[model samples]
Target: MFRAARPFIFRLDAERAHWLTVHALANAPWAAGWAADPVDDPVTLMGLRFRNRVGLAAGMDKDGIALEGWQRLGFGFAEIGTVTPRAQPGNPKPRIFRDVGSEAIINRLGFNNGGVDACVQRVARHRAKGMLVGINIGRNKDTSPEQAVDDYRYGFEAVYPVADYITINISSPNTPGLRDLQAEAALDGLLGALADTRARLADAKSVHRPVLLKIAPDLDDAGIRSAAAIALKHGIDGFIATNTTIARPPGLSAKVSGEAGGLSGPPLAEKARHVLRTLRAECGTSVPLIGVGGIDSPEAAKARIADGADLLQLYTGLVYHGPGLVSRLARAVSTS
Candidate 1:
């Protein structure tokens, strides 16, 4: 059904189709059951319990303003926002792309959002459904690397109450020097400072919400080691395994090859798995890792479990496959 509807949607802008899908799913009476049953992907991560392991990734809900619809999709959990402290229109239009043949997407969205305050109020309104809601936090484009910690602190404090767990997104290549925060010295300081804030928030609230770090897929061996080590040192609760890659890789060098954006979907699957395995091995068997990037099927989600991911998330794959993809993935995992 979604494939038949794709032509009309494909004609519209990517962002508009995204909102249209959100509204459609929200109104569909059967979407809740359609997206959420037959629990094969049951879950627990970072001391928090998720009803399932499948989740929507950060970019899907950039403002936390789209929860009512997402919760109905039957995701064991849903993460909203790579929200910044304040609102800013991201990069220019045509920043998002679709590679139909690969069932993938490439985007340079640049963290455009309605800001933390608005997102907090909106997310708080629909958080009643019991599904885990994660808020992905990021620094605004204008924030210098030196001031990044304060930006993260602002977002963490503001969005903390409404989220089940919070994800720190420092790996996006589009942001100026943002991924540089992943370095050994920078990661140490950033994670250490973030941990202090997380501890304070946990103490005051009398609740321990996990703080998970999302990393880039392009890191070299040393970078991964340093990142994993710093995460442990700072008491970071979990890891998102990866964000997007800056490297185009051998598979995706098409005519759209030079397009400046993060490439995701099929071509990214293998490397994403490798990174998940690396993080899992580094963090040891006990540390929780949520895998993301290029999850297109129940098989891929299952591959994640096999690769040592405690859970999984999707964005690009969902766009190409449409609404039914969630149920397909959920059912597949349930049977596995």
Candidate 2:
């Protein structure tokens, strides 16, 4: 059905097509039926039991608009947000561009979201249905980099009660000065404060939720090692390596290739896999890893696992291949 509809959907603006798909899934009575029975491959990581290893990545459902819908779509889990503390308009129009030839997307959407409070309410309404949901949190665009720790802490507190895991997103290229948090000194301080906050939250709530750091794919080898060291030192439960890349791959169309924002899709697979392998090597089996980038097929999904990703996520791949991709990858992982 998605393959048949893609031509028409792809005609619309990339962002518009995305929301249309989300709304359709959210509203469709038959949406759950669209997914095949999920492959039964359970794994315990970060103290949570995931029904399967294939998950829908953060950017696909930013506002938690389709929490139940994702589970029905056969995903083992779904991550929502990159949401800020307060609502913001994000970047101007045409922030999302599709590079059809490359099977990639360039998004400068700038963390546009309806704020943490709105998403919290949404999650509260649907969380009881028993979906394993991860909340990905970020600072507002206007929030200063120096004061970013406060935003992360606030996000952590707001979503702690409901989240299966919390992802601290400091890697998006669209937000100015956001990546600065990845620096050695900056990362240490920010994560230390967050760790302290997590301990307090856990104590008060009597529930210890896993915390994962999402890093950019643009990091060098030394940078990856340094980030892993910081994650270990701060007791981060896991790592999502990585976010989209700022560097455009060779042979991309100049028209969309030059557009400013993070590039995600097939072009990002190699770098993302490399980073995952490096993180796995550095952190060993103790620290879990969720790999996302250019995974669109069963083989790609299996390869990510081989490269040390304990779990996998998809966004652009879903756009190109449709919801069936989730079940296919889940089955592939299970049989492998």
Cα RMSD (angstroms) for every candidate in the order listed = 2.0, 1.2
Model 2 misplacement above 4 A: none
The TM-score of predicted model 1 comes to 0.94
How well is each residue in 67-104 modelled by candidate 1, as lDDT tens digits?
A: 76666666778888899998989998878877777766
Error of 1 at 15 (Å): 2.6
lDDT tens per residue, model 2, 204-322: 99999999999999999899999989988998989998899999899679999989999999999999999999999999887899999999899999999999998999999988888
Per-candidate TM vs. native? 0.94, 0.98
For model 1 the local lDDT of residue 135 reads 90
Candidate 1 stretches with Cα past 4 Å from truth are: 26-41
- Tell me the whole-model lDDT of each prediction, alpha carbons only: 0.81, 0.90
Q: Give the best candidate by lDDT.
A: 2
